[model samples]
Structures are given as C-alpha cells and as structure tokens.
Target: MEHRITLNAIAHIRSSFPEKFGIPRQGGLADTRGNIVFEPEYRDVQAFRGLEEYSHIWLVWEFSETLGRQWSPTVRPPRLGGNIRKGVFATRSPFRPNPIGLSCVRLEKVELDTPEGPVLHVLGADLLDGTPILDIKPYLPHVDSHPEAAGGFADRVKEYGLEVDFPRELGAEVTEEERRIICQLLAQDPRPSYQQDPARVYGMRYADLEVKFTVNHETVHVVKIIRSMPD
Candidate 1:
C-alpha cells in the first residue's frame, strides 16, 4: 500500500447555508443553490470546457469543519432517530476515517469569463458556505443511474414534509428569493429527527440572517428574522 496520499482544493462552494445546523442531510433534499468558484491556480477556462453539457456533476469535497477529529467505527445516524448505532461504513455520517463527502448537484450554468474566473452555478446542493472542493466530475447517466438500487434501512425511513408559515411582518425582512429558500429548508424539516419538542425554538443562520422558528405538530412557524451583526 502507498505510505501516504495528498489532495488539494481546486475550488470552494458559496452557498446560502452559512452553518451546518439547518442543512439537509443529503443533496437534492432541498432546492438550495450554490456556486463553485475555482481557485486562482485552477481558473483556466479549459479546465471547465464542455462541463456545461452535463446536467449534473459530482463534487468531492472535504469536511473542513470536522477535520482532525477522532472517528468511531459505529455511528448513531439521525435517520434512525439518533438512537440505533450502525457501522460507519453502512451510513453516510460525516464522522469517518476520511473526512470527505460526495454530492451530485444540478449544474444550472457555467460562466467562463468572470472577474474571479470560471464559476459553476448549481442547484439542490446541501453543502455549507465556503466548503472546499477537492474535485468535480460530470455525472454520467448510463453508469451512475441505478434505478433498482435499494437504500437499505434508509429506504425504510419515511420522509415527512412540514408546513412552513412565515408571518408577513417577519417574512418581509428577507427578499422574495430568500423567503423561498427559507420555506424550502423548513419544509424539509430542519429539526433533528430525534427532537420532537414543539416548544423548542430552533435558530438557523443563512446568508447573515438568523431564522428563528418552532415546530408545532406538522407545521413550522417562523417566529422572527434578525440580521447578524458584523464580526
């Protein structure tokens, strides 16, 4: 076996999700948008030549926020109500031997000429803002599509969409676009699967705005929206 291996980030993701707390567990769960800005060294237009032809692309990225942390072989997946432990290999838990993640996002567009060089606009991404990307590969439908694939225990976990109600006064703070994205995130039920306390108010940060909401039965009520103070 090779003694060691190394990887470098070719680009970084700019997304609305400024923090991890409210991000969807997997890509495509929410209609979140993001952009991939290539690093100065990899800014050549040739690097992304013909990339626009593909509708989706696979992103190989580092869990930078969780790097250098110890990992366990068994992990309690939030999908399992955060109670049942399963082998790390059988789950998509971020805490693993290698702090890496793979996600396939819809490529909305690719701009070759920009003040910052080549950029790829994508949709339905679950990545946090400023995530370092190790590599990007076009998704091949013939090879990547598995129509009959079973998701094991994951398939057994039923998905539940929540109703989002943002009062006009509080919702007016954000633009129409931000309001839509906020509703989309809350519809996917951002609260932990194990947490069912209706009285508990959850706060999620997105693009410098703090969204405060509470879950009452199957509905998520937006309580307030506050602009974050400059650091």
Candidate 2:
C-alpha cells in the first residue's frame, strides 16, 4: 500500500529575485530581503501569536518552476562546475521527486496590521519572488543546532570569494542596500563551475537591473548595468 500527502500554501514570498538565474544557491548566502504574505484564509494573527520569539524560521516551499520537470537519479551541481554528477539526494537540485524545498531565513519582524493580513519580514532568504510557502516553523537552536555535523562533499569543495568591481558611474546609481547584496552575491561566484571564460560576459537578471559581468579567476568585474523596463 502507498500513502499520499497534500499541503496547502499558507503564504507566498515577495522578493527582488523575479527569476531563478541570479538567485543565491543557499539561504543566508546574501542579505537579500523578502516578505511573507499570508493567504487570506490563513491570515489570522492568532496563528502567529508567538512566532516573533524565534530569531529564525524554516520555510517549507515548492519549486513551482520545476514542478513538472523530470527527475533524475543524479544531477550536476553548479558548485561542482556543472560537470561532475552527484546523487540527486546528495544535492539540492530543484529537479526533485517532490519538487519541494526547505530554507531557513532570518525572521526580522512580524506585522499584524497589514491590509491583507499578517506579514512577516525576513532577511537572508534565497527564494524567488512569489514562491509559494507550504508551512512555517520556528527554528529551535537547542534542538536543531548541530555544530559537529559533517557536510559531506560540500565540505571538501574549495570556496573562494570573488572580488567584485562595479564601475563608478553605474555603482553610484545603486542604493547601498542593493550594492551590498549584489556584491555578496557576486562574491559567491554565480557561474557554472565548468564555464570559466574570462572573455565571455554573463548577464544575470537581478531585481530590476540586468547585471553584466565577467569573471577571470578570482575577480568578477561588473561591465554594465541596464535597468529593466516595467512589464
């Protein structure tokens, strides 16, 4: 016999990452901010009465874009240069059997006076705009914290912080908050590990700007910044 499970979306995330290309690989990788807007039916303040006590929360969400995509036993992770294949269960590939994702994000504040209902402001979230949230649970440090846990292959990978250079003129146009977040994202080296052509420029859709950059080893130079037109 087999059992099936069904879940309802309690809230949705509102973020600057409208697309998936430039999203950080993991939550808390960048100081990017997002808002969790509860669904009308689940907007009661009583549901989140004691939620503000926790510093962090876990968001169980769906990979809506990859919902219908086929799943494979193995996947190529960007961290591995997109060339080496690892067991899908060992990697955080969006192409999963269930198309589900879990993220731990900083819970900044909980507002109960929103017009639609209660809203949760979060920081360091890597979710895309309008991502459906299935459940919200408070993170317990005493029970969840495991300092001695091994990271498996992720621990063996050499990490490098890319030096990001934004042109003075274009850099001036970006706000301090945007600049900080963008730089942090670039520091993580947002490129396929296998593609390392210094001459080749990469375009990433970030927020309302088209960020053009080129990476040559340890450095990422921002060549141009084009404002995306409104839809």
Candidate 3:
C-alpha cells in the first residue's frame, strides 16, 4: 500500500531575511515584522471577513531550504546544546520525513491592494523572505496554550536578561519607539545557548540602529549600538 500528500502554496512571506542561518529558531521570538502576500488567485476580499477578530494566526509552511532527496530518522536539536540527538518526530527540527514548519504569528493588519491583491501584515515570523506558505489557520488559545506542557531535554535552558548600554553617539540618534523594540528583543536573549564566548560580537538591525552584543555564558551584555546616519 502507498499513501500520498499534496500541498499547495497559498502565499509567500516577504521579510528582511533572505538567508536561513540567522532566522529566529522559533516563531514569536523576533520582532513582529513581516508580510504575507497571498497569491493573486486567492485575493478575494470577501475571503478575509472576520479574520481581524483573531490576534494570532498559524502558518503551515514548507521548510523549502531543508528539503532533500532523503531524510534522517534522528536529528540534533539546537536546544540540546547541539550534542544530543533526538527522534525526528520528537523535535521541531526542519530535517524531517516531511519538511513542514509551523509558526504562530501576530496578525498586525490586512490590506486589499493592486499589487499582490491581498496581503497580511504579520509580526514575529521566523520564516525567511519568500518562504512558501501552505496554509493559514486562526490560533485557538483555549486549545493551543498549555501551562503544564513538558519541554523534554530543553527544560534546563537558562533565561537571561539583556544588559544594554547605549553609547552616547548612538544614543542620541535612536527614537523612543526604536529603543523600546530593541529592549524587547534583547530581553529575550537572542544568542544561541551553545554559544558561550564573551569576545564574539553579534549584531542585528533594529529599525535604524545596529545593535551589537556579546554573550558570556547565559548572560547577554550589550556592547555597542550604532545608529545608521540618515542619507
């Protein structure tokens, strides 16, 4: 006996990330800032009725970058310090029998326009730019949120607060709103758990400012923030 599954792309995400390496490991971890451009054929405004009532939506997408001719049954999860291997089904690793990815993102707004027809303004998406979106479903909090959910081997991961120090030169350039977003992102401690080097500088673009930091074990301390000068 044989079985088959066919999926179609309904939309594509437009984001700042063109590469996968730096994409957030999980959705809702990064600043909410991405757009979903629906295929022109599916752009009927009537299709989006009452969607605004939901704060979040679930994106079922293909792991386009990880798909291969064969798949391994076991995968190394970054959460496990990249040392232990886990069964593919037991983890959310992209290298699976089916390279499907799930992300729950905040729905900022929706627009019906001429270019892409209908576009969904979403925040906190971890997907790369031009990622194929297979389906969209409203998040049902009652069914999705679990207070007692177990995290397996990842339970021991440490949470650290970011220590941000703004340089005087750059400090004067940032707007209040930009600073708030940077603080929010830093509070989450964006560095990988396996990374412990204190000398390495990591930077990410937040609005007009370039934030750089170093991780000393579980603690993330800000090193520098340079605001790009206006052209």
Cα RMSD (angstroms) for every candidate in the order listed:
1.5, 1.2, 3.0
Backbone clashes, each candidate: 0, 2, 2
Model 3: per-residue lDDT, tens digit, 91-129? 898888888999999999988765778889998898888
Off by over 4 Å in 3: 172-178, 203-211, 217-231
Which residue pairs in candidate 2 collide?
81-193, 81-194
The full ranking of all candidates by TM-score, starting with the best, is 2, 1, 3
Clash pairs, model 3 backbone = 32-123, 32-124
Q: What is the TM-score of each candidate against the true structure?
A: 0.94, 0.96, 0.82
Model 2 alpha-carbon miss at residue 47, Å: 0.3
> Which clashing pairs does model 1 show?
none
Q: Give the TM-score of candidate 1.
A: 0.94
lDDT of 1 by residue, 143-222 (tens): 99999999989889868688999999987799898898889888888777899999999999888899999999999999
* Per-residue accuracy of model 2 over 53-141 as CA lDDT, tens digit each: 99999999999999778999999888887878999999999989898999999999999998979999999899989999999999999
Best of the candidates, lDDT: 1
Give the local distance difference test score of model 2. 0.90
- The C-alpha lDDT values of all candidates are 0.91, 0.90, 0.78
